[model samples]
Target: MDPSDEGSSGKRSDGQIPVPAPVMEKKKKMMKTKMVRFTQAQINNCIAYKEEEMPDYDSMPSIIEILSDDLANCPQDYIDELKTIDDSREEDKTFWIKMQNEIRDEREWILRQCFTKGYAEYEVDIDDDDDEDNKVPARVAAPPGRRRFRNGVAVKKNLSLSGGGSVRKI
Candidate 1:
């Protein structure tokens, strides 16, 4: 009888340590996305439509610039508003949020004449490996999702992609 095998209760008897078998991990749920490669003609058509029919927005004013101008002209605009209601009351926690909502409202108004009404399903990424300047991007960035006060507590809200907001909703 092998001395290594003596007094064994189905345990390893070879005097060598047994390494545990690797555990099969549960398959993780990955984001489901289908890549649709547009033909050169399709790409050209899109570019052509924007170039031909769409009014040029190259010199269009941005919200950042607009707001900056507004605040710059009157640095105490926010403070002034706060003062009129209650400046002495601790602090206005929802002031910034109210400003954010105003911005959202303005964005929605500006985008009322959008090409598409709702969100887009497909997100395109340019796979070009070139490290050059002025490279073209296919499609990207859904930035919507704002903090809205619900019972004075901030809650998430969704905005449409047409309003330059996110595709996901809350």
Candidate 2:
């Protein structure tokens, strides 16, 4: 049977009811929302916000008391472990102090090398035209120590806390 011919069911041969495509089911659209990026500045702002909004420090001792009580409830073995950890930390601290001293000594050696003596000399120009004898009086030479490193690097270090004269270097 042709689709153009009316069917005995009192409808067209096409399965659709021909009612403007049933309004297309309204095409339920998904709502899109923007994704916000979190930055360090924004996090810092949030931390500072509570500083202005939160309560004062009057209850600090009470908070400390509560924390102490909570800690007191912890097992003895855990406290012993904490003490052991602290002792181990002290051992490591001594090692670190030794290493720091070694580094400081190395830096001092480098500074000494940078300011070694006998590495430079100084000269002064003399004119014979002013002397009638064409020979000038022998100029008193600079001290031997001064002449050797006259143009070498010099440094002055000042004491920070105590009131005293500074130490000079050459």
Candidate 3:
């Protein structure tokens, strides 16, 4: 029997070695959690359909821009639909509350999916093995050229590619 094996008398009892503590442990949940409250900045970021906000989905800036522009030139029927939605909000407080809740969900989703800072700055990552063929080139400094943001999709850039030699750029 090894002398060090004993706690005091150098006699082993269980014949098992002691296990060390883990390097990393799971984090504990926060007790005093702050709830997310809606603000004007957040409301401004909302992606609304027509004048009313689009609840429960991503409200992309492009989507909002398209809706606004379309409303400006949209037919009376389309405008009526928008007004109906607004009227529903005015008539039913519960409906408005539901919409507001949906918008909150959308806001959270947007913050999760898109940039937390509101705007995303896309930049290519450079690796050690970068070369002429495999090089991570910088984005084009020139303007995107004639590609206006229409209805959240690129209007100038053709996305359809169906032919012998298919070519589509967005």
Q: Candidate 2, TM-score vs. the true structure?
A: 0.25
Ranking by TM-score: 2, 3, 1
Compute the lDDT for candidate 3: 0.53
TM-score of each: 0.16, 0.25, 0.18
Candidate 1 lDDT, tens digit per residue, 62-160?
A: 444556656566657674664454432323335545665675564454344233532223344543333244567878765688535345443334575
RMSD of 3: 24.0
* Model 3: how far residue 1 lies from native, Å: 99
- Number of the top-ranking candidate, with lDDT as the measure: 3
Write the residue-wise lDDT of candidate 2 on 1-170 in tens digits: 55445444545435644323244455434444443433446434433442122233333333334456576878878767666654565566576667767756654544444347412222344444344446668898776654454355554545677655554555
The Cα error of candidate 3 at residue 26, in Å, is: 56
lDDT per residue, candidate 3, 13-126, as tens digits? 575554444589765433433334445465455544334644532222333345786787778787777666655644466666787788677666656544465542233434
Off by over 4 Å in 3: 1-91, 115-170
Please list the Cα RMSD from the true structure of every candidate, rounded to 1 decimal place.
27.8, 35.2, 24.0
Query: Could you tell which candidate, 1 or 3, scores higher by lDDT?
Result: 3
